[model samples]
Target: MRALRYYEEQGLLASARSGSGQRLYADTAVNRVRLIQQLYGAGLSSKTIAELLPCVDAKVSTPESRERLLVERDRINAQIAELILARDRLNDIIDATSKPNPTCDYV
Candidate 1:
């Protein structure tokens, strides 16, 4: 709930107020929140997400927005590649240690 209000304050989301002044959200709000969460997970800042939201809402992309999206995608790809290498290295270490060695004391 706090996150919803924060998102709203950041201009990343919208809500309607009831007569009693409670915030109300449309059904589409669910999908919007999910997309916002995904973008944040992808390491996008709130400012960038705010900029991207209009493009998303309109289903149209300007050249700048397209470039920004591509840049973020490339960054995530590079991070993924680095993580895979680290995981493979850990696996190699585990494989070597798991083999029985006569000189090793630990079970």
Candidate 2:
């Protein structure tokens, strides 16, 4: 609930209010929240996600928004590449450490 409120405050989400002031969300809000989580997990800042949200919500892109999205895509791709490299490095370490060693009792 706090997270929903934060997202609402950040303009990444919207909610309606009932007569008793309870929050109401449309069915689409679930997908929107998932997308928000994905974007954040992909390393986008809230501000950048906010800038991209309108285009996503409208399903229409202006030239400027298209360019911005392109830039963000590139950024995400770079981060993916970096994470892949890090994973490979960890795998290499694991392979090396997993070898049987007579000298190390822990092994």
Candidate 3:
């Protein structure tokens, strides 16, 4: 809970405290934070993530916003997939380069 408060102060989360100082969050806030983390993990700029949040929260023009979010998700997914492929290729190269030379002619 204290960590959550810190996150709020950092603007990674948003909430309001009650009279007793218990924090209350907007229903969508956790989702927003998850989105922020996802974007960060995908190598997106915090500024870009900041800029996109409001439009996403607006939930306006139904189909338009939905499509936009889908596009973002797809872009992130593609980046992840490309990274995985690159990793596999790197492993293959490493394995091939590290193969033991069985020929004792050089010994």
Candidate 4:
């Protein structure tokens, strides 16, 4: 709920209020929130998400936005590569630690 409210405060989400002052979200809001989450997960800041949401809402992308998308994709790819390297190193350590030593009394 805090995230939803934060998104709203950041101009990334919208909601209507009921008579009792409860927030009402349209069905489309679900998809919007998911997109926002995906963008954030992909390493986009709230300001960047705000800038991109207009194009998303219009279902169109300008050349600048397309360029931005490419740049962000490249950044995500770099992060993924780093994560894979880290995971492989961790797996190697785990493999080394998990092997049984026949001469060890503790085994």
TM-score against native, each model: 0.90, 0.84, 0.53, 0.85
The alpha-carbon deviation from the true structure for residue 69 of candidate 2, after best TM-score superposition, in angstroms, is 1.4
RMSD values, in order shown:
2.3, 2.0, 5.7, 2.8
The model with the greatest TM-score is 1
lDDT of 2 by residue, 34-62 (tens): 99999898778899889889899899998
lDDT of 1 by residue, 1-107 (tens): 99999999999999999999999999999999999999999999999999999999999999999999999999999999999999999999999888788998876
Instruction: Report the candidate with higher lDDT, 1 versus 3.
Output: 1
Provide the global lDDT of candidate 1 against the true structure: 0.97
Which lDDT value does model 2 have at 87? 100
Clashes of each: 0, 0, 0, 0
Model 2 lDDT at residue 23 = 99
- TM-score ranking, high to low: 1, 4, 2, 3
**Per-residue alpha-carbon lDDT of model 4 for 1-107, expressed as tens digits?**
99999999999999999999999999999999999999999989999999989998999999999899889999999999999999999999889878777886863
> Model 3, which residues run further than 4 Å from truth?
1-12, 60-82, 94-107
For residue 71, give model 4's deviation from the true position in Å. 0.8
In order, candidate lDDTs are 0.97, 0.91, 0.72, 0.94
Q: Where in model 1 is the C-alpha error above 4 Å?
A: 100-107
Off by over 4 Å in 2: 105-107
Model 3, range 1-107, lDDT digits (tens) per residue?
Answer: 67566556556678887999888889987777777777777766666555566676675545655676678789988988998999999999879868677873554
- As for TM-score, the candidate ahead, 1 or 4, is 1
Minimal lDDT window, size 10, model 4: 98-107
Q: In model 3, state the lDDT of residue 86.
A: 100
Best by lDDT: 1
Give the lowest summed-lDDT range of ten residues in model 3.
59-68
